[model samples]
Target: MSTTPTPTPIPTPTPTPSLTLTRPAPTDNPTKPLIILCDGTWCGRETNTRSNIYKLAELFGVRIGARIQSPDGVLYLEGVGLGSSFLDYIFNGITGQDIAQQCITIYEYLVHNYTYPTHEIWLFGLSRGAYLARAVAGMINNCGIVHPLRIAGTNEIDAPQTRLLCETVYNLYRSPYATNAPHAPQSLRFRQTKSWPLIGDEDPADRTAPRFHPPIRFMGLLDTVGSLGMPEYTGGVGLDWPVFYDQHVSTVVANVHHAVSLHDRLFVFQPCLVSRDHARHCRRDWERFGVTRQEWLPGCHYDLGRQRFRFLREFGGGWLESLLASRWFGFASKVIEPNHVLADLALRWMLLAIRAQSTTVNYEVVANIERVIEDVTESIRGRAREPGRTGDGDVYGHVLSYAPFGSLLLDVVRTLRGTRGKVSALYQLFFDLRDRLIPDDNAVVYDFYGFDEDIPGCVGDLARVSERRYPSKSYVKWRLRQ
Candidate 1:
């Protein structure tokens, strides 16, 4: 009877912490920063154009030296631009097969080489290369990176199967419906079955969501132009090529720095401006965590990226060729030479941006950037001190004093079209016709940052001078309402 009244209360059981799979913690090994440089259309390391992307790669190689091949050193890869070869150039430069193949190649490299959580990925590109860089980042966001060990799976024979699985992931990535939802069933199942475990905390309630990995550390782009399938000659074409709509600058990238050409007015080379909402979101993130900048700088497409035609060097040598190479017909050099200074300024700005993120990059890269900054600063100061020089006079003076042959050709076209030298009306007619024929969301008007905004501190003086320089008259005329 007493035992029944004095019975001890049963003890409450302590719950054991639930176990969830996660990416392995980064080891003691130093981070191996993977730098991928994508060149603009028809540009590469071997090309005479030598875009900023190429130069940056060369600089990284020079600085990294033997370490580039070491496991602990920076990993570097260069994607030859879209139209780098004759065969590649045959399909209007935006062929889906070429782009998809390039993306796959880069993806394969990451799968085979990248060390999850211990390696950083950085991207640098110019023009269409910028578009390609964004596409690669988008692919990683849509399809989480596969574990390198899982790719080989303790045996070499599994490579083909791994590759097939990679293709499957990419095909799923290309599907709009699969990526539109945060936890699309198909993508989630694929990731859970084929890729590495999600890198962060897992939520049991939302287990179906696909979690991406190996965030892009930084992306530096120069004038991203996403006019897919728009032929260079016609400016608009209704081709059914795969358009990369997911390549917009987004938060998945820890940092983004875009150097835009304030004077690129070609209907086919319209500047791809970041959306106002995205910019604001990036600004908020910058205030709290990282950096994102889109700066407008002086120059045309080639002027900003630095392209030199190799036609004469490639095929000119005979007496007839010499005549074409003479000063009167030396349009190739004249077209690109006067703009080098402005291009260098842009390069300096980008190098400074890279330097700012030096913790993730090689120390030698930082050193090379400093040296470049010194050289460019001295050049700008010397030019600025010239007796008759003021503002961008040295850069744009040639254009004003002596128009290039292409300018003369465009003038002739304008006169033939009966525009009576009204370049704005001529360009307006072309744009209006393009809009009417194949109206597309990608055909949005160009929106540029004010010349005075977002100037890098290192290039502040030079930027002011560049701002004074006159932009392309035609570009100024074609500045459409956004």
Candidate 2:
């Protein structure tokens, strides 16, 4: 053995396994961002109606390159506004039972998927859906996000228990005097508690300490109609209910963007306007950064939200419909056609706002959005041209520029006969009276082309009559016939 001293055949020092301490790629991080899109009453993907909310969902999908509800990527949730069915519309929609349920649905989603302070929440909505969005935000403001309950010895979320927790939290949020009174002690306790069993835990020594989960990143609203019932009827039965009225901008919401319809004057469709005082106080941090915006864009609610074209395409029919549908083929020849261009413009403005305010930067989303803006800008420019002016000019000639005047009249009649008949006619009458009585205040009116420095692209020379022209001081003058 001393011979060739196989010298303890020095075991080849097993190369210490080199460990490359590498960080996860940005996409691989456990952080899960959430987006909740709540569509207007009777609107949702199931209905195949492409409202702004629907389009937004599509844009988000494109941006993430994943289907909604994908486990590996962003979690997207949609709350079909109150009326998905006639019965549902009558019972739940009218009474706001649907709104409560929708809030619970969203809250449960948060419980299941929301990661503590790391997750970002973005909400978007139209009409009643906007109310739903605000309500959910308020719930989160009052009752912190509920932690998901997991099954014993497993990673799976306990769905029933999580739902029960969400319901309990919501009840506390909507409790009597919730808005006026100090935060409910139960809700505060919930926020301070660490786990899902939610049994008695040592309360924080400082009871008055503000308790809440991470603030909502952004809330984008289009024509937020807070009324609970049918617009045709008196502004819903529960107009004065605290639940409906309390859906204000909470301090926990970081940024707010509201695009209002300047031309809408329906008494029943009263806007739940963002509280300017509250916005000023809550968004102090973002206001200097110019992140919060509330613009009164040109058009009716349908126009601002871009819901009519798709809706009409789906449900438009009758003698009037046949005629309008016929003329749609010759849309290029008609001047003063439906305010579809205005709708497109409104959509573009919202997209720009989202791009500006979103915390995450997705180059593909930005590029796609830019392309959409360019295309929309070009279409608007082409549409704004006078008849018989250029190759893209109205082929029907200048005299025929007013030819669509009859079509416009027919459209009005058609609208009067449709589901929106009573409401649309009433608003039209009010607006007509308003225009006649109130002197046009150019100073107060917004120029369609008066592009916000933040929002790029020119919208041509269209003038958006200020919503103020209808009600505000002008209304008193009109009432007095001064």
Candidate 3:
């Protein structure tokens, strides 16, 4: 009787795709971590000629519409809808849906269609696409908290968007998963976008507050200003684009908090340059609104897309090699310069630290400075050592590459201990070096200081800039008195 009761066979349970999806293995694994890329609207439809999709294909080791698996067991889903066309990016951009909403739809579509292993899911985006990346990453945090991965190494490279994204994601994770684990630090490079204040506007009121503040002004300042301001700083100071790139980049690397793991290989490049009208106004905003100038890398926004791949590799490394190394994203570098007050404060701290790092101006410290100088020189040279020079052919404009020296300065400052006193001059020296590095072949000098009343073009751009005002020494002194 007992045996008869056990004779009823159990029915087989249907397997869940989510459950069945195993993490992709190191070699020949079916389950792969999915990588979703949302292409910018500007990726042109003409001849499939524009967009970073091609570079991405190379990076992901997969052809278009093919499931490419990496050694790390990640899956890459390429998001190539409309390239850089006006209808795609600007007018009907993301189908009039805010980037965050659009991103959720894309993620849902991908998740339903594809088998994503429980392994890490990554999203790579460019320009407008980054909005999606930011949004989707936020959603992921909303869903659940992932624990600490790992953190190691540092880099000083062009692009602030990368740092910001990393920071933003870190914050999201920190907010949600703070009690459990800290998220890793990651970076994405944002290219310079067109500045506001529109060209041909003479009145500062165009950028100034209307009735104390306008919604557009408030939102734009809070949202786009930080990410969009980098070019202004590079352009305004006439800094060597490359050298300037190298300096602050290192600082970004240093500031990674312990809670966040670092993404070592992933690099995001965005070099956004808009229409002449946009560029003009962006420059104007620089002076009136105290906005940073625009740092454009010649070529149309679509054409410069290739430069993103460059950032993934060593500066001299060809785009493909760099692309190969980057598992998540790629594009030309762009960034919103940090707030002036914060930057100044950081500069002061670094200066004091540098002096503290070296008790005396002995050979060691001097040697270190010289080494920093040489490295910076090499970085600058590497940026334009080729026959192309800084700005070559029709794709022409000044490019300032300030690497190593500026980068090293950040590292020195970050590690330096106690400070002797305020050394504003040290910060000036760094900025001055960047200013001197600007290539002369361009149509105009990128004036950072706004010292050039004679420069007509840069003024308009300066007027439109929206970064936090650098409180004058007098203002600081006055505040202290109160």
Candidate 4:
């Protein structure tokens, strides 16, 4: 002992193991992910009282499995004034103001009072809220440091980390600038930047970047009364986002008719300014990729949020779904694997939660979308019966023959499920979309009992009229039409 002379006691630092917890499975008593709602233009802690905000929360609460369906521990933040440091600097030109930090503070508050069996957090925002969500997400992921915001001189607190299922209203008024105005370069500056929180630069190996960007995706409605494509707004210019993100992300542009049309709207005409291409561009891109534009009808930005469509709100929004679902389950299958069953279920729950939460819906959008689906279905059915068809017997089969068309049709159906309303011009718009999708005259092969005749005169006429605007490109368009 004396020889050993107690070598100056070496203090062995105990390493902290990564934190993990067990909760009831979703089926038995699903743990709800924490729900945080960021405020819109002028929001505050009480935003949950607002119709839109409340609805989003309710829907999210209903979405978590069973245990958390009530969302008692859910925390709501206005995400207004000054919070996210980056946004505070960007919006208020003030440095070190972190709204995201405030978010973390609120989150920590819940942890103290609640069990926090699940780390998955569900974040909802509209317009300005979207920007706040983005900033908060970045801060949480980039810097483990969370800066909680003081609410109306409230006590200091810890913010919670959440999986965001945020939706931005791309309507004229909600955008950075009014839809009818001139395209501003500053509006899209952020989109052009390569760095963003969570979503990183495009991987050269992946080609979807130029279109989908990162976590942010564009969901537009169609209506001559509304703006088309991307509007040049002072803020929320997704075009400023990375061309692609290593984080697997995708975009869905449901073509709801007339309520929020993009057709000849100024934004639609100036695709270059907003980094957006016209329907022709989407069509052309899809054609090149052997896919087609998936056009749905009757729903606008708001309408899509109301209805419980798994594809638009969740399945397609895998970014949000995987984040929330895995938060509690700790299941890598849903987060990492493409087409994982749990992931799909998570998507369904998201849609259900959103639908359950949102009460506001454009009735007109619902009717219009339903009508469009009917029209397309009838249109395809009629085409299938032509005297000189030469392909598959079933209507779906013929549509699937053209992979692009099939994909487009599938998306259209998906949108219809989430939309409402019936604009008079939507049927015409469908024909227009169909025409843009199928440009070749001889390529319209309707194979009914090997007759191999031309497309029906009605479809053919629509195609011809719609073709010149969208000239035939040499791209090898896929023949699938879902």
RMSD per model, one decimal = 13.9, 20.2, 27.7, 23.8
The order of the candidates by TM-score, greatest first, is 1, 2, 3, 4
Question: Stretches of candidate 2 above 4 Å error?
Answer: 1-32, 45-47, 62-97, 152-154, 178-182, 194-213, 228-247, 276-290, 309-338, 359-368, 383-445, 449-482
lDDT tens digits, residue span 304-404, model 4: 12211111112222354335333353332211111111111112223333333223322111123333334433443354344432111112112222322
Query: lDDT: which is higher, 2 or 3?
Result: 2
Looking at model 3, report the run of 10 residues with the lowest lDDT sum. 217-226
Q: Could you estimate the TM-score for every candidate?
A: 0.64, 0.62, 0.27, 0.27
Clashing pairs in 1: none
In angstroms, what RMSD does candidate 1 have relative to the true structure? 13.9
lDDT of model 2 at residue 30? 20
Provide the overall lDDT of each model, using Cα atoms, as 2-decimal numbers. Answer: 0.54, 0.53, 0.28, 0.28
Q: What lDDT tens digits, residue by residue, belong to model 1 across residues 173-232?
A: 666674533256655665566555443334456655433333577789898875444332
Query: Per-residue lDDT tens digits of candidate 2, residues 253-333?
Result: 657888776655444455666642332233333343234567666565655665532212212223442354354644522
